[model samples]
Target: MNARRCDDLRLTGSGGANRVMEAELKRLVMRSAFDVRVPNPKREGDETLLYPFDARVAWVAACYHRTSSRISWDLCSSAAVRLEPLFEDLVPVLSSDDRLPGGPELRFSVEVGAASDFEASPLQLRGVVKNAIVEALASRGVTADIDSEAPDVVFIVRRAGTPEARRTVVGIDLGGSSRHRRGARVATGLAPLRETLAAQLIMLSRWDARTEPLVDPMTGSATIPIEAAGLAVGAAIRHPSELPWRRLAAFEGLPGETPDLFPGTAAKIVALDADGECIKAMVGNLRAAGLTGAAFDQSIVIGQQDVRRLTPERIEALLPEVRDMRPGVFCINPPYGVRIGGERGEHELLDLYDDMGRALARFSGWRAACFVANPKFVYAFGHHPTMTKPASNANLRGHFLTFQF
Candidate 1:
């Protein structure tokens, strides 16, 4: 048996919210049997390094925006000598032979990050790496197809070690598509939260799927509510191993198997939106996600109501079905006035927030964890949160502030 070595792996999150992503990574590691170590932040500029120690960590890979595993920092004089042996080494270790029947007619793309002194065009180097891998596979009697542009596999080659003493590092992407694309989000609102960020916010809110209830008063496109429902109902979402990589002949682990993270617990969730168009979009998205039928109907109640007019009575009126779910979270990703289009100026936005604060005051016991772009407006809501954390979505900057009633 080849012993699993702890290679340098990189798991990506949002640009400004590494801490939130780091927290999620830790949570994922906690559920595993492996003794994984999540290192503290060591970053240059905006790039943060989150190293999770494990060889077979496909389950947690989905929670990350991108991942690069099996980092090799070995100096090599030639591309063929470097890449061929790398592919050959990975074939057995990843258990490629045990992949799906007929095996994966593989597609691949190669990217090289080397200095100019060590010359090789991206295309020329891609061809070299491609031919080397193909030849290696042929030697093992494994037939595969390689596509450069639209590939099932991606191999990244970078200069590692140090500038003074650098080595060629090769890493394989576990899958092609980012896990954030849950295949459920077909429609979106003007300002939609990234699926992973929504998941992160849900985690940060500390809602228990088995016991606590969840309500998204401004549930644009139903991303948060649908994700919560998927958690509640134990929906089968795909992971990295189930991707095209699973069809590799030497891939060993069982494909299509995900962690039983859902504990067969269903939460009472209610999603509300002021715009009729937004509610319509939410309904269509929920249906596409297979969140239908009587139970789901009772669990998730979507309707139209302006958030500005939200009151304790109005909240109950919207979801009269939430009989036992008292004092649940009102998790929302509201208009940060950055991405979501609104004609309202700064003064108007402040007033809108002020009104929202007053409306939320009516739900005396219910707490809130909201993503606010402008902290200045956070005070518009009469009460201040007990804790605050920085957050970001792509280019937009924000903070997640949790208020306890």
Candidate 2:
């Protein structure tokens, strides 16, 4: 394929959660005082976003964005299926820019897109791409090794465009690991929500982490609560220095190795779970995320409580600081009943939803946001949602519903 230069960086976020990512990106840009432009997706339903290539902007995005899964330098795009032409343009850039690893030995891997239609299988396509990259690097006097199990760097090769006019895009992964693996979740419960998805729910709810309180009534694994706590404190999702971008030549001379986090405020966050085991997991996750001790206790309160019994009075009792405060937010991810054994389990889950609805009604002047895969939740709750946003939890299609209590 003949290589075409791309002057933008690419960020891929979770499907059905692009809106949240866009909003978060804009906020980050504003806080960082960067003049980068945030543009809409090229096409509807496309999860990839493009931004003008600025080393600082890319670094900030790689470090602070809670919604992006992968950040990459848009190396080249081409209509040719062959790897030679693509790397012809890519190799010169890597070699001159010092993008290749400088060590005595280098390890790398190639990831191909599932939807990429090629004459070869996915495995074969990966092999071809790897060979092309290695040959290109070797020609530039850089020795590299193929290490799929563990690699210092990874390259993403994907096919885009229609079948009639297919195109191939190549990028170097700026972060070696997926951003969603925030390095805090040491333990998880059944149907644990993804950390990025949890952040999206919080953003979508418009929960003011500073003035308003946030509660997760069914805090399985405490993903929602942990994310809320981080947001309240203006914590970077992950440290900037941990990313691989710093080691690359393309990002050389960029300042702010230590990202400037948003100014945080004292927040009253509560996490509750009926299952003792889940509560234990939550504590472990909290500790892993460095949210412990008396100071943390003042801001975040955790306990075991059934959702049905979760009244505003119960919350006030847990932390008296919010007794006279303004209306807060209720962010929950309740059971979806897919894993529950059978008809009896489904009925029990529905009943639980009914009880949850009744308990939520007691919290006057509050807002509740829930993501559930089951449509029965609305009927059981007996309330029309103020907003119904289409979202997905893993492979299951779900809706994020908001209720005014």
Q: Highest lDDT: which candidate?
A: 2
User: What are the per-model numbers of colliding residue pairs?
Assistant: 9, 1
RMSD of 1: 6.4
Every model's TM-score: 0.72, 0.91
Error of 1 at 394 (Å): 2.1
RMSD of 2: 2.7
**Per-model lDDT:** 0.60, 0.76
Residues 192-272, model 2: lDDT tens digits: 888877888888788998788899989988899888887665577756566665447777666644543666578889999
Error of 1 at 333 (Å): 1.3
Q: lDDT per residue, candidate 1, 311-361, as tens digits?
A: 777757766766754777888887766643465576677787888888777
Model 2: lowest-lDDT 10 consecutive positions:
90-99
Measured on C-alpha atoms, candidate 1 has an lDDT of 0.60
